[model samples]
Target: MSPSVSVTCTSLSFAWPDGVPVLTGLDVAFGPGRTGLVGVNGTGKSTLLRLIAGELAPGDGVVRVTGQVGYLPQNVTLDTALRVDQALGIAAQRAALHAIEAGDASEGHFETVGDDWDVEERALATLGELGLGHVGLDRTVGEVSGGESVLLRLAALLLRRPDVLLLDEPTNNLDLYARRRLYAAVTAWPGVLVVVSHDRELLELVDRIADLRSGGITWYGGGFSAYQEALAVEQDAAERMVRVAGADLRRQQRELADAQVKLARRKRYGQKMWENKREPKIVMGARKRAAQESSGKHRILHEEKLAEARERLDEAVEAVRDDDEIRVELPYTAVPPGRGVLTLRDLELAHGARLTGGLDLRGPERVALIGRNGAGKTTLLRTVAGQLAPVSGEATAHVPLRFLPQRLDVLDDELSVVENVARFAPGATGNRIRARLARFLFRGARADRKAGTLSGGERFRAALAALMLAEPAPQLLLLDEPTNNLDMASVRRLTTALESYEGALVVAGHDLPFLRSIGITRWLLMSEGELTETTWEAVADPA
Candidate 1:
């Protein structure tokens, strides 16, 4: 391994217990810089990170690291009973320091606090850097929100100051504020930081992008934008190659046909000559033999040339990527221009978040719901969806509504994608449901796969298909962090799906780019127990 390389995996191969291969004979190295590991979901991105972090054992080959490694997994789950300091992995050190301060300077306490008398201060500072300064060391993990817990875990990792740090989908549950803090931390990272994330903003902070595809890594200089630009250029070249190869193949076919025609004509002429006794027997026989051998050679040469042209065309076509998009029509979901979609009158959600002056959504108005974690955005959406009752006021939907939660629990694990959609559209025939699912990119066997066996992106599509293809044809759609844990392709698929949704939308999420892409006409912010209409500028700046 090169000295510059912080982590190296040589001929790494891994497979699940079910005999599903993820990474096969993959060799890659992460040097001393921030690397954004990105790919479509289930492409072994997380698995690669785990292999480097030593959280998972590779089935074959080896992984080597130069220094201590710290990892924050995709789903961070700290014990609710543990204190903030304990979660930070500094409780024992802090205790020893306290003991030393209280005049019990025992040898064990000294050893525990050796060269780490400032552990507490560093921990607090790390917490502060991650916007967790408000959280005291004594506070239990249960007191913090999910987003805060993610940050807390990150803080613990930062406190370690490891030479190699691995983060998998670190921004999955973070709100805008937390994400910004993480971005800042990533900007200042000094070690080999490998982050596996679909967050474009987070990926933008990396020095390079390592795109994992088909068990191999393709290195791209710079961040997500640069990678995208490079991919576009490559795709354009690949398409051109395909076109050129296709033209060559066609030309080859034409030449082969011409050769066969000439051969047939020669055979006819020879046969006529032979029939007319135009030449002596020996001469005719010689001429016939020569013509037959020449014709066979010509046919073989033309066929070989045509086959080579076809092979070239196939190779060129293989270089081009197939990024299939969702194309669906939801005319039934369209709301009239002046139709009343939803109303919240003096609404106080079950979780104490309220709309101070009430809200009335009309027509096909698209609303973006923004808030800090624990601001009750989900609660408000649930109230409007009729899953929760407002504390003292009314929350009503004027049209058929569907709520797609963050968990995507709408799908049953045992049910096939087609079966799940059928459950939603009980009145629709099996063929009809299957046809609609095809629009969501779940054609044929893909639609028949059990929901439990689907990848993250596939599972998301299945759940979305169920909601969008419901029997009543929802006119009011409530999506909670619809982009969460979704790969870039899946996010694009979501955007495409929503482009065809001519209905009122209320989406609660921290993904500003996604919200902007969806054409949010109204931006609402939930903060300090109140909800208020805000401008896009205000939402973006938040000052």
Candidate 2:
């Protein structure tokens, strides 16, 4: 393995085909060690990764790398019919070795198997290292779960052993076990690794943090915790700078006001002296002209000082982060403690997972649905929301409910944010709806942006606004993986917004941090064919 690898971007420029500018004149570099690339959803972390991996070409400038490069994208879709060996890019070599063993003795076979005589053993070991020992090379990809497919894809890349690796949201769809295995692999990687992910635990394993914002990367030593500490210190300093600049501005304004008062008083005195005829007309006129010139010079000096002070204050404010705030109150969403919100009896979902016996949610219980991939959490949430009916049993809701799916399909892409919200609340006046959308960070012209053109974070916020601001006010809220693609700031904002909700919430998500932050009253584990009550510790270390 190479001891050193380097990836550099110089004067990099790129944008979508539609001419939406993302990055311009950006420059950054990665060398040897894992670096966590993080930013808000629309800040182009993924785009930067793609450009480095050669998946997307930059519009201008140069991307230079010293050795072989490999990449794993945010969403991976492989042909299910492919054999494990084929997916791993070793099917032909394996077949060639088999032919040689059967006494074919072909020269082409030897060439194919050339230096990889133990290719089968090495492939098996790679799979084993990734917690996929049961995944046989000859087994078809269709036999494995989505999480296993991710591991298989990684196995293929590991077999090649590229010197530079780029991972974009690699943990997005992975389960706990798979995620642990990946974290282990990242710890052992001996190359330049650049990963873009919102998973805090995954990020904590990095050697450094690369904070990308507004076409620039700010380097932070150590992991996520260290980056946060540094950010806090920086923010405090920025706030202090702002305070100082503001004081200077105020002082300049007061001096200007005082100067204005003195100038006016001096003008009155000169006029009175001129009217008294106490001196020759020429002498008084010359004195008055001299005084007027002196006053004009003083006024210009104070005005320049105040302008400079204002400029300094603006610079200080720009240095501080301007993360959007989400503050919306819905008191009408509250429900009585004894009120029944939802009930499911002998519920066998359409996706084949069963809520065996029964399930019930009363009052404002916030239940966190925890499980592995394909555990039917989404199915169960959909069943209760009336978007999908139970296969055999009844799933009913007694209160007004709203469902936010993983895909956020509730909004119409063709419609603007304002139009979409209006669709959800037909009776709401335009002025009232605009007032509420403002709290969701969609002010005036922003509310007129088409849903299709919104960023991932923006789309989620708009969807949440549509649901929470619906005419009836959802007393029971169902969210399926709502934090899937959101950044840390957005996640915090979502948590804060949910804190104000007084109704029952059933959020089916794998984000444990988010679930806990939302103050879940109960935790339900979905596995096998049953829904079992569990605790936070159990979810943390499920056997």
Candidate 3:
């Protein structure tokens, strides 16, 4: 590794107790720059981050860090009793500075202060940058929303000023405004920053991309788009190689057949000549032996050549990913254009949000629910899905519905994926449920694994499968932050699954690209206790 590399992993290997290997013999070096770590779910992006952060020890090899490392994990849970200053790691310093300013200064206070005399000020400034200005240093973590807690955790890491920063899915719960703030922070990072995220905008801020797959990493210069372009080129080349290898194998097979036929003809003609006494017996026997030897050599040579060509083709095929997509058919989910899917008549949610004019979804309209943090987007979706009753007025779903919440709480932890789906679809037989689960990438015994053992992306998929495969065949599909914490491939699979859904869709999420990809026909922004109509462009540029 270069001396300039801030983080290096040599011959790293790790495996679960169940013998499922994640990273094996992996060696990589991260220098002073922003690198986006991207890959499909279960590819160990998060696991690698954890190993680099020393949170999880590698089963083999070593990790070397030239300087301090600060890691922001995907799931941030701050203690409710923790104060903002303590969370930012400035509470002691702030107290020391105050103590020295008020009266007789103790040497201990000076030592604690160190060089950070304005620690509190800096902490507040960091909070403000992450749109947490209202959160006072004395405020407890319980007072903030889930999104704010994530930002607060990030703020704590940023305040550390480490030489290497590792952020795993840092923008999972952040709103659009917070995401922009994070993007700005990433753009201005001055250390060796490696961020594992599926957020397209965040990935675009990276200086390079590291695609982790099959226990190896491929480095691509520039941002996510550049990585995609490079991958496409690689796939194209691999495909061409496969084609060439196949052609060679066919040619070898044909040559082998021709040689065998010619050897047979020679044997017959030589035998006839010997029988008619056309040539000496000794000469004919010698010629016959030579012909057999030559035929055997030719056959062996062609067979080996074909086998080698096939091996090359197999290697080429392995180089290109399967890219098998999630295929689902929901013909029963279709709703006629004139049919009413959902209607909220002057609805007032239990949380006290009031909708005066109400809201309605007709036919297969795809609605994108956009709003800032604490805007009641999730509450509205839950109300429409009948998870919560309206405080006043009427909220009705004209069709069978299902809600896949952001937290994916619908799944029972103890139940296996197949059993979970069975819970939602009691009418469907075990074989039928398993067959559908296979489409969601849970083939064979994978479907029998407990939901608690699943990774973040797998959990999301299982939850989605349960809702989509429900017995009633939901026609009003409600999704809240569907892309939250999902890897890029999982997001693609989600989009693919949604494409096959013929029902009315209402998705509340911060992922604009995902919403657009799902063909959101209408945009609704909730603010100040009301949901109002909006456009994609307007939402993108809310000037």
Candidate 4:
């Protein structure tokens, strides 16, 4: 199959049943080589990919796909009935059949029989590229970690040699090493690629950047680093324009006011002179007409000036404000820690029938729960949160804690922002509830907006608000992949907030910069429920 593909969308639009248009009149084109799709959390980046993959049809407009395409969604539930090797073999067979159907028989294939040897060679090469060459042929798919399963899918896609590869948030749960390896492999890939990811490092490796926002795609003809620089420049220009425009509007308003005041004063003086009856009739009449004309002209000019000022102000406001993201302020309250906040002795987790291992964590110290996908980091968190009991061991926590799971499932999606906040802060009045919500950027009518309507970032902000609004703040905060769908700006803001937090934090995050920025002092790596003490290194300058 040809390595290059072209995709184009014209006047495309789509919306849910309630008529909330996710994409509107969007037009975008993708060519060969790697491309990064970027946008805020709820701007429909993933929706666009689905549209391209033909998983969802556009409500309006046309999407033209010029070649065979393979897509990997942000998340998938792999069939567990098949063994790892069985799944891989099934994928390979499919790829071979697909290639034969496409009439590509260069690498393997008899004159006409059996699985194409050429296709088999290509499939094995692709698997090797994904670091899955040693995957035992008999291993079950259900036995592999999430990351391993995803890598398997990726390998399958490559083997298929589709003209285009669409990957949506492919590294959401991948560790630093795994993510880096994936990046390297993708950068070296020889086909058209469109990836939706918030990993700036991965974006840096792409050939072009496409930013989807407000139902449109703005194509930046450079890599992620260049895109960042360009965005900075754009923001600076917009800010300057806003300042200049505001000044001009103020000056115009002042000038118009002064002109009107002078005209009114002149008219008053003329009237007084006429009232004395010393002036001739002609003089009085002329003076009155002159005053009337001047007043009319002044009123017209004032209106014109006001209108001009409003136009300039609106332009400046749009330029300055529309590009910026809403900032969130997470509240921090001091909490007294118990004698021992967390204590665990000889705890273990199992994968399949084997006793994977044991963990012993005892301390007043801040612990970091770390592990690869399927290594039981989340499982360990659940156990610590008391949501799940340990298989066999003693685990204890003395203080009232707050556990923010990987998914913000505790939030009431059906409630409004104010309602959600009020649920936890029953003593707070409506005004106070709104005030607290505003701190998280749910100001004005947004406080009344349903939580279900909120984007991922907004949902996270709401979650943060509810936690902080509680009278007795949580002394322990357990976060799992807290930065999952958050943009870089929000991530930085949250990191700053967490830095000042007085409570003990047990966070599991795969974002390298984020983890480092928040200052992870200790590392407790979890593997199959077994915790191991690993040296935490600065990924930025890991010499």
Candidate 5:
């Protein structure tokens, strides 16, 4: 147990420009060791990180931190021209200068600060520790693979050795080996670690899990496994509470109905007695008084019970909001292969002249092209889509094919959802196009909203709708890293839709759970200028 660094927050709230509130009132404390931020995609995990990083100010409440913090963003784009050593050297020099300016310079500064020589050597040593010793120190960031760049960023951050390390999906693009290496380094880190990731493997290394939902934080001691178990228990409790609330509401309604019936009968009897005039005045007055007393008492009791029932219902509904998992159902419109969809024999793809080896793809087969980042997965997708010519080998696809690239590049940022759909499906009218977009969850005025204003998830959904509207409708679909930004529900829905599709599917993604859920039968693992069919044992069994 190391001495912990503490971060305390009280009554924090944040809202975007669209008046969408992210955090309502969040209060939590972060101490030393690794702490994972876990939740669904839209649950403000990234926003909270930005807030802690001082990149964005909280609209309300206080965020207090003890020491320096190092933040590694999920998107690690870097300058391509600078060598790995140069990239880290700059950061070190900046830190050194800042230290000197702050009057913290010591005899150690003399050994580290001269002529950019000391820091560059130290950078190489740090890179070696991160399992990048083979990487030439002179190699530019852009010349390396995406996974390598991610490692480079990690190396740079590690050199800083701040009090707290904030990592956002650090292993998203890394291969299994790189991912394991990252985990090892995280475990070895001496700082207060707060990692925002959906990877279960990464979460297992954490000391605690923090779930950010509905503008609040729920802390679970222990690791990801413990958090998951606690969430299951909470979900079960929520279900029971929902059932009890519904029952109470129904009982209240029944009592109210019975009271109304009694009142009606009493009125009718009093009217009959008056009309018949067969009873004495005293008896009639006594009957009227009894009726009044009964009616008053019943009305008061009904009101009280109804109020109680309504309060219970509200509480139950609130609990449901916190407990209900996201549910997304993708449209199930599958097109069958008429003759053959695609044919590839001895095909080759590469980055520049570097050969990515030979491969074969036949029609009517769902193919999963998988590998670490920069393994030419996207390049292969482009080749299959006829957007890129293969460096060598024969390739042919007769049927119509639709391609959804890793990024939603097909979307027209200037146009609204309706316009994007209408442009893709020119035969359709505004109403028809809007109706089509609505099926993908863009409804009413939202269909008229500009695509540029939409979130990353919304953009992906809109793009899917557009692709589905192609004339001669595609019999084959190719997706590249489609699940990167999708919420868990969206991922599930997309999987379900693809599962039921009749067309041949070729997907390139690193999401293990998603791949298993969609039922990938075979995999094409891309590596250093080679593609091979590996055993599917790498996939974990679904829980």
Candidate 6:
């Protein structure tokens, strides 16, 4: 964080072309410090970052910044033909320097060189810092791994020396080693750094957390853990207020009832007196008028009290967040304890990565596939799912299997969520599928939404539902980076859904916290064309 850089949004607003509002009149300021911008999916975290980065225009209001800004979007796309120096934005400078060294210096070359005579050195240093030391300046972008391409983009940003840097889910496709390198960069950032991510480890490196929700930002000092603690305290107090307000509402209702009964009794007594002619006509008329006025006043007073009580109750309820959890039974996916799940015999994948020897998985074991970017975890999973033929050896599944790829392409974009689930479970009736989808948090109209219209979180839930609720009830499940790009709440919902799965599961991901939460039974390391058994402690501290 630097004191010279600042970012502020004044009366900011934006909406999609479909007229669905995302952010409206959002006013927030980011001072000199690393800020982790977080919220559930569809809360406009990425949209706000885009607004700040000038990638998207604000429909209303203004965005102000005091210095140059660089943004690393969630999806990093670089032309395969681009050279490393070109990707880092230093190719022109390097060429000018080389021309000068060759005694061919022109005024144009001098102008391009300017005062940054050590641009190449700085570029190499930044690349090395991001664990791209082996990547040569002249190498093509396609020569590097996907994770390396992400780091290359970040290096380009760092070379610009911008005062404000924005990153949206920077760790989405990165492996554990690459993520560590990214974490180092974030820790050492000197200017204003705003990152939108669900990576708990990355969030923990921030100076503060700005939670975007309900079209506004709630600032919390410290990292993600502190933010969670503060939020817990706030929610506890809100629940207490709700209880108190409910009690007051009930009390007001009872008092209103009692007042009405008393007024009725008085009216009855007056009527009886009038019938018996117990008082003079003039006095009786005066008494009747006074009784009517008192009754009206009393009735109005009680109604006002009841209204105030109801309003207070509504406010109290609003303070409590309604984050629903997925609660579905997946008994059909259950595998027998003694069942043979999968087997591999000296498996060699199409990509030239091979297992050292044979491997066997039994029962309802949950395996965590840990590897670097190009280690063939996905290829192995695909082979197990029978999507690919192994170049050598064999891979076999003893039970029904399903693979949820990283891209989540199992869904049909043209169909509604209910229709998609129905496609997977063709044997189930429409009513049965809808009832099961309700457990995935898609109830009523939500189930009717076209899959193409779903947000990232919603799409993940829909895809998961379609798979988990399939007719054959896959007894063996393989997931490749299932948590990538998912917000924390959606990740939790995924975990909840898996809790009831009762099947043999194999997940390939770098999210250690999530893997631990889902109770991974075994850890397998894929490195250098070999698979070896490992432990949680070993993976966490790979010294």
RMSD of 6: 1.5
Q: How would you encode candidate 6's per-residue C-alpha lDDT over 1-543 as one tens digit per residue?
A: 448679999999999999989999999998788999999998999999999999999999999999999999999999999999999999999999999999986999999999999999999899999999999999999999999999999999999999999999999899999999999999999889999999999999999999998888999999989999999999999999999999999999999999999999999999999999999999999999999999999999999999999999999999988778999888888888988999999888999899868899999999999999999999999999989999999898999888899899999999999999999889999999989899889999999999999999999999999998988999999999999989988998999889999999999999999999999999999999888899999999877
RMSD of each predicted structure = 1.8, 1.8, 2.6, 4.7, 5.1, 1.5
Candidate 3: residue 229 lDDT (0-100): 89
TM-score for each of the candidates: 0.97, 0.95, 0.93, 0.85, 0.83, 0.97
Off by over 4 Å in 5: 17-20, 81-83, 89-122, 136-139, 221-226, 275-290, 321-340, 348-364, 422-449, 468-473, 538-543
Name the runs in model 2 displaced over 4 angstroms: 1-3, 275-277, 280-286
Per-residue C-alpha lDDT of model 4 across residues 314-365, encoded as one tens digit per residue: 8877765343333434344444444456666666533321123434323334
Candidate 5 lDDT over 205-253, as tens digits, reads 8999987776677889888778878877877787788789889988998
Alpha-carbon shift of residue 151 in model 6 (angstroms) = 0.5
What does candidate 2's lDDT look like per residue over 409-441, in tens digits? 999999999999999899999999999999999
lDDT of 3 by residue, 186-229 (tens): 89888899999999988888999999988898899999888888
lDDT computed for candidate 6: 0.94
Candidate 6, residue 246: the lDDT equals 100
> Which regions in candidate 4 have their CA more than 4 angstroms from the true location?
1-5, 82-116, 136-140, 273-287, 321-332, 335-340, 349-367, 426-431, 538-543
Q: In model 6, where is the ten-residue run with the lowest total lDDT?
A: 1-10
Alpha-carbon deviation at 350 in model 5, angstroms: 6.8
The order by descending lDDT is: 6, 1, 2, 3, 5, 4
Q: What lDDT does model 3 reach?
A: 0.89
Write one digit per residue (lDDT tens) for candidate 1, span 171-273: 8888999999999999998889999988888888899999898778999999889999999999999999999999999999999999988888999999999
Give candidate 4's whole-model lDDT: 0.75
lDDT of 2 at 383: 85
What TM-score would candidate 2 get against the native?
0.95
Question: Regarding TM-score, does 2 or 3 come out ahead?
Answer: 2
> Considering lDDT, which of the candidate structures 3 and 5 is the better prediction for this target?
3
